[model samples]
Target: MSDAFFSEVTGRIPYAGLDSTDPLAFKVYQPDRLVLGKRMEDHLRVAVCLWHSFNWPGSDVFGVGTFDRPWLDARLDPLVAARAKLDAAFEFLAKLGVPYFCFHDRDVAPEGKTWADTQRTLETVIDQIAGRMEQTGVRLLWGTANLFSHPRYAAGAATNPDPEVVAVAAAQVRSMLDATKRLGGENYVLWGGREGYETLLNTDLAQEETQHARFLAMVAEHKHRIGFKGMLLIEPKPQEPTKHQYDYDVATVRGFLERHDLAGEFRLNLEANHATLAGHSFHHEVAAAIAAGLFGSIDANRGDYQNGWDTDQFPNSVDELALALYEIVRSGGFGSGGFNLDTKLRRQSLDRTDLFHAHIGAIDTLARSLLVAAALIEDGELERLRAERYVGWSGDLGRSILKGDAALELLSVRVLSGDIDPRPVSGRQEMLENVVNRAIWSVDRAELAAIGTPVGAAGRG
Candidate 1:
């Protein structure tokens, strides 16, 4: 193919209204349309990820890559292929009309024999990507270093027992941080993809933790030294490449950050699939992050209900997404982070244009979810009810207990006086569920098909 890489899709994907039936059009995701006194694009800053969208070859454990991406063929010169891949990716991003994209350092540039050579190659590509971004008006959401893919990181990266491997990982992060700043990326992410031990037999738990903390401390220090203004983000996954991940979930990561005194230095980049893998719902993770003021960005994807691992399938469930968005909107929106589509197509959907279809549908889903979330927020029922449930905590006794003026002995005396006897109140869980359902159902979809009924993960708002 020529430079017009996505020739199958001739032009930009336009935003048609809800009544439009054009297959390639965005029915609900009108970027400029106002949702809550702000442009929808500003509220939901949607982005595509380069790693899964282009770098991955549609391969799985049991099969080779089945997609028809010529750039992925190993026979071609890597630098040549990298330029071609960037061309295709820019064409796709420009046509899809997404405002931003995210990437790992290796996704756009192949490594060289020496560390200096590797940096040189990456530098060339970074300049190229920056030029193309200027032309296309797309931005970099975040940049990360892929530390787990290489064999050198089979044991771990920051937590590796071997000091050299840890040093290499640090170098990669440093380069990625530089690249992110150079590209005007809004955030720099760290996913300790292999930062955990498979077993304790060969692991020094405390030492590994200390090493990981030290690595993070260095990263934070480097960010200031380089004057990179973006947020430092850490992505959490329970387990995958390793039996246990140090950043297991949002709460786990929060604890780790606080323990290391790095909580203020970094925020979370929550992934829906990772939340599922951690045996929690996506909204649970989102709410937890928002509650603790750790919410930064989102990896917008879902996992298969039947599968027990990280599926990373395109998010099609508006119900689940709405709840998470509710938490996001209620918390006064993201600081400098946005929704990056950390999604991939099913191996079987091999058409060249399947990429367009997957993204179009997912984008519309996000738009509708935002509508529902905004509606719920405006309705104010959930918040009112939630506050009512905790009304006792605002009482004199509550303030006394919180201020440490009411001692345990005094509380025991009060309980023994029988005046503190209390009866349970109705949680009205189903009624709260109805409030969300009503919002979703009442959305003004002109003639579009109804979305699926929510699979209950209960309330996360």
Candidate 2:
């Protein structure tokens, strides 16, 4: 399809239109055409999460504040700067060939007014950015509601102990859903990082879980009645501020949605860092969600167990990403969804755009990984060699051979002779090495230097 038509239909450009040498009005940027399958816009949109948008020291007040005053002031300048950043980011994304974005509520309304007034501001911002998004061929994956924003819910929001607090949380969700619909969002996501408890004392698990389910059901019903077309994405995080969270993993969320009859309309936006935090491979989580037919979205990032919760680092590990790429490549390449860089910047980085380069580098690495994996799989001998290397030595065959010709044959060197060649398998590994090694050799370093790279660059613009 034409890029414009594709953009209109999916609210994004198709994978093919990502690279245009026909020169637009923005900086000259072109992502390496590595992953030969499709463009980020056409294949599946890549989004930047707004969790790290503010670039402020005191912005976490939305999560830990007693009052919203200080947080509001920090938001103003960052957002004004962010709008410009958004333009640049879109230009960068367009050049990278990825399209579509998932916006957090705070990206637009970072404590400028009352909760109600902030909601209105969100609506206005969406309207304002809609044109620019169209120009850049980016579409909305959805909008997020900051459920962990208020201190009134030190316990939780929808799952709070207080009935009044739960009511307010639901009300905000309803409004946010409306805002999503108004902006032509494709889906809405909820990440209940604060829904679980650090202590069992005075905690009513049944009541809280039930209330949370009821809140989701109500939101679904309300949106259904209004004929809202967007789906809902429920992301799972193990724990952070609280010792345990309600939607701790995909299985937990799957069970909750099933019990609440939200399994169909609500799907999982599985974040890689969350999976790593939960002690599972990120690719395994993606595969699990896909197997359950609930793989709706992705929050792409990495984490380290040695650190605190929500580390939000880039997925730069090669082997981990190779496995992930293999899983998705074999599954037809992220069928109908997108990847959102759910990353953040620490107090360390002074430059904002450095975060952008880091994200770009991470994505480029993954793209290369995917390409190498697909090549290995299609090479015709790697899979058979791997199977022979593994399955022949273990399982029932190893135990069943007692003491006859069979046992003698098992010990026989002839049995291990040549079901698969080790040479080709070595070549596959070497091929992967070459693919990764050549990633940088293909880069035009001189061109990058000409761009006048900025400093203190942080945040995935």
**What ranges in model 1 sit over 4 Å off?**
1-3, 445-461
For model 2, residues 101-220, the per-residue Cα lDDT tens digits are 666666655554577666666666666667667777667777877778578778898888888988877877787787778767888888886799979997989998899999888888
Model 2, global lDDT = 0.64
**Across residues 175-286, which tens digit of lDDT does each residue of candidate 1 receive?**
9999999999999999998999899899999999999999999999999999999999999999997999999999899899999999999999999999999999999999
Clashing pairs in 1: none
Off by over 4 Å in 2: 1-37, 54-97, 111-115, 380-461
Top-scoring candidate (TM-score)? 1
